[model samples]
Target: MKTELVQCFVWGVPVYRQRFSLVASRPATERFYRLIRSAMAHAEQLRDPFTGDLECDETTFGGARKGKRGWGAAGKVIVFGIVKRNGVVKAQPIPAHDRASIMQVIQARSREGSLYYTDDWQAYATLKLRGDHVVIRKEKGRPVGRDHINGIEGFWSYAKNWLYPYRGVPRKHFHLYLGEICYRFNHRDRDIEPMLISLLKRLTVDDVDLN
Candidate 1:
């Protein structure tokens, strides 16, 4: 079976690809994705910004398995993401989208003095005390001034677009996918070489089996 591995930087996003006869090697794409993400999680970030016009939103993604709306979405995946005004995005898959879950993420990622923006989700009301919280209602539009949640909403659009092209992704490993998307969103304007090295620096020998 003819097999090949390709490495390409897609618009500053370093992508590693493997090609071979499915009849022989089959596909280990799942393992590859997990390895990449695991390596990323280890990389140290100089700053996990928790300030600025932080836009927060939640979305669902996964397979066509049997289930209810959000309920069926259970076991699927729920991703909560935050983006700053400058187009940097951070996303993670949460076990649930309840207040506790959302709060935990916010507390971990947000700074004390940074502003936060979101829709009228009650889960974010507590942020009003933590920092400047701006809530937009469906009937009402986003804030007119500098505080708007558009950046995060734009991230949602980008994420769904990329996922649709890949068809339905498996639920078991959705967080890695989310991390890749966020990495792209966060560094869309910069060269990916540095980003790739940064991610590699985070990896230990056990993160990926080169052999």
Candidate 2:
């Protein structure tokens, strides 16, 4: 992958174009993309910094729909993301924002002793009893303690402004889109070529799709 990408760079083709060329073989490509998807699926794990005493929260994805407010949401996907103070972040799409949905994500990603920070949402109120849930009022002012949810918020902001260039993605295929985003987020500091290489190493030809 590195060699091919370098070849593309020297030849003056876009990386995506190079990606297309690399996966020209159908059987190999299908397996390749599958590996990429798999890498994305387990991308998020609570960071060490946040795990010691963390601020956790959930938020919805997608932009405002033209005709209506919540109607626009129905078409958009919902995701829950958390950032530990140490700067590790993890995110996943959730089916809904109900208690069961939120709890499942929290338990899976968060450690038992971690400090959870969140807004005054009813779902997070239980954090106090279960662990150390600190509630804040987003409108009241800024939250206190290590209760800042800025990390996850920043992720959403990037997703909306930077990554949504394709616009109006179908809900059915949201996971693929998410996999790509998670890959990028997990490797934020790495260059595009290395980043692609890292992703490609774990994935097979099945993971990426140009068509």
Candidate 3:
């Protein structure tokens, strides 16, 4: 790896690209991003199942558009997230926000008996059979009781804020970017330098060509 590539990792891709474009070519920058994407994809597979109080929710991602807004928006990506209270979060872009789609994520990421907190979405109604499902109806003001989906809702805000600076992400590659966000959130407390170095080592030894 070139010194500029290491600098790219240290300073972050956007900063390195703006300041050192003359030092590293565009292809090298893209390669580094691809490497990060590949490492994130790998880390996503190692998630442990959620077993405690979990929050589940779905949110739409996209910029301001001409037509519908919020859940009814068109041309936007729907993402479902399951977050263990005060723990890790797992999120993915789903094809739809239907029962089958949301249930698939819950079944895969959460344990059978874990307590689930969600809004009054029809899709999550089936979760009652599989777990202790708690529904909090959406209201004008803040929630009053112990029933709130704030954990997963916070993750959605965090992800959207982090992604906002990029303007917009391409739909086809959104999954990879989503994986990266989840990886970052999962490892939020760790020292990024060592974690990134370890990922780079795995990238090299795993014989996976990210190019």
Candidate 4:
């Protein structure tokens, strides 16, 4: 059951509750999804954080309905993210865009002495206290020379495009989806199939203990 479940998840040949639904109930499939999500989240968190050039940024997710867009729009989830210039990114749906909230992610995932970039948001003002902070003013058109927060911005675009298939993610499961996105982005260059399978197997020996 464990191997079968892991294969089903990695293949995506049949999405959640697709072929699994034929044999198991909806609740069973849901439980399996939750279990795998936990494994994925734990695996991603254990990775060594970035200590090199970093790009910080924020973006809102899930604004499909009609209403205002960006920041303060209804039914939107504000996500704070930091991406290393070369690759690996870490992101999560934050409570608010305030300094207190955004700083938590920065402090947890980044190390001091690293040079970085960000948009002209006041919340990231204190990043310089720990590392070299380079501010990129978005209103001033394209960045000159190598000045840009393009890495984080590119991550946002990649995350949104990857999430399109899910249609809409539930608020309760938003963190898992965001974590999955970060994991995918970090491992985008390599084949993540074996890593994902290894994580799943470690989390479950015989079958998922979803209790």
Candidate 5:
């Protein structure tokens, strides 16, 4: 059961209760998801603040509804993300894509004077004062020059793709799901099985024996 759960997580498969019901109870399957979420949250918390060349972007999450799409689309959760070139990426749900909300994430998760690469979003205009901000003007379907948000944009794609199987994530539990994606992205090059085993051993209740 444990091995199957680990495989599901490593492969980005949704561990539905019905899928694991033969070997594990419904509560146990839910517990496994919680454990995965906990491990991911811990890993994300331990990540170093992003420095140097960085890409920042905002994405909206939620199903299609009656209204606008992208940017300030109503009823969708706003998520702000930052990725250091060839390094770690982090994302969190925000209340809005306004200047204050965006800058708050930048100040907390990034280092001072780190070069920020982003689209020509007005919210990012103030970032120029704190660091070297490169605005990538969209040309046709791509950004001009070497300036591109592909790194962070890739993360959004990776996250959404991984999440699509779940159909829809509850708004309250969205952050935990996001954390899992961030963990997967950050550890993309590492052998995830051993890392996951270590985290599980440290976090799971099974490790503690009752007298």
Candidate 6:
């Protein structure tokens, strides 16, 4: 396996990576990375449901961050996210930020009976029946420890930072990019090279959803 090839991508854009670019054509390199992104890019790659102290939150992608704070933010795409403290994070773009829409992701990505933490939002009120829900009031100010939904919030920051380097991703391909973020965040603590290589090898054209 070409470890450096994988390293070039994991580190950052390969076009600027002179060592790899010198040996491989820029077009080839670009195509290779796109293939990688497509191959490993699917939220369904997460086979297991998350349990434990899960933090749920939402963030907007693309468009200028103007008007309405969250869901109704003009021209922005809404992505619902849930992160298990000290564990994996799952994120998916949703058509609406309503209770029904957000709950669908929560139910599918996480197991029942897990404790949930979030900021004051009526959308999450439905989580109470599913499990214990702790609502953190921002007016009261954030206290120390797991009292806040920092895990998922931190994920939002990390994802945005990762996406920033790409300049802009078209709405059609955004989910694949988001899936790549989730894959990286989920396996962050491990020796990622072997795992990524294995995942790259295991996946075929079928894993990517072009439509």
| Top of the candidates by lDDT | 5
- Per-residue alpha-carbon lDDT of model 3 for 1-211, expressed as tens digits? 4455655554445533355454556666666676776677678867777898999989999898998787779889999999988989999888886989988888888899899898887878888898798888766857767678888888999998878766787677778778878887888887566676677677754734353
- Tens digit of per-residue lDDT, candidate 6, span 1-211: 2576678778766355454344577766656666667765653455588898999998789857657766576778899988888878888899997889899989888888999998788888889888999987775466455488888889999999998877777687788788888888887777666776777778756675654
Error of 4 at 122 (Å): 2.1
lDDT of candidate 3 at residue 45, scale 0 to 100: 63
Better of 2 and 6 by TM-score: 6
Model 5 lDDT tens row, 1-211: 7887777667766657357344677667766776777677767866777889999999898888877777767779999999999888989998877989989999999998899998998889999888999998987979888779899998999999888989897677788888888988888888788888888778645432111
Q: Which has the greatest TM-score?
A: 5
Ranking by TM-score: 5, 3, 4, 6, 1, 2
Task: Choose 2 or 6, whichever is better by lDDT.
Answer: 6
RMSD of 6: 3.1
- The reply for model 3, stretches above 4 Å from the true place, is 1-22, 204-211
Please identify which of the two predictions, 2 or 5, would achieve the higher lDDT against the true structure: 5
Local distance difference test values of all predictions, in order: 0.64, 0.60, 0.78, 0.76, 0.82, 0.78
**Candidate 3, poorest ten consecutive residues by summed lDDT:** 8-17
Worst 10 residues of 4 by lDDT: 13-22
Tell me which of candidates 1 and 3 scores higher on lDDT.
3
* Model 5 TM: 0.88
Candidate 1, position 95, lDDT: 77
Q: For every model shown, what is its TM-score relative to the native structure?
A: 0.75, 0.70, 0.88, 0.84, 0.88, 0.84
Per-residue lDDT tens digits of candidate 2, residues 3-35?
A: 554334323342343454663454454444444
Residue 53, model 6, lDDT: 91
Candidate 2 ranges beyond 4 A from true positions: 1-38, 42-50, 66-68, 140-147, 202-211
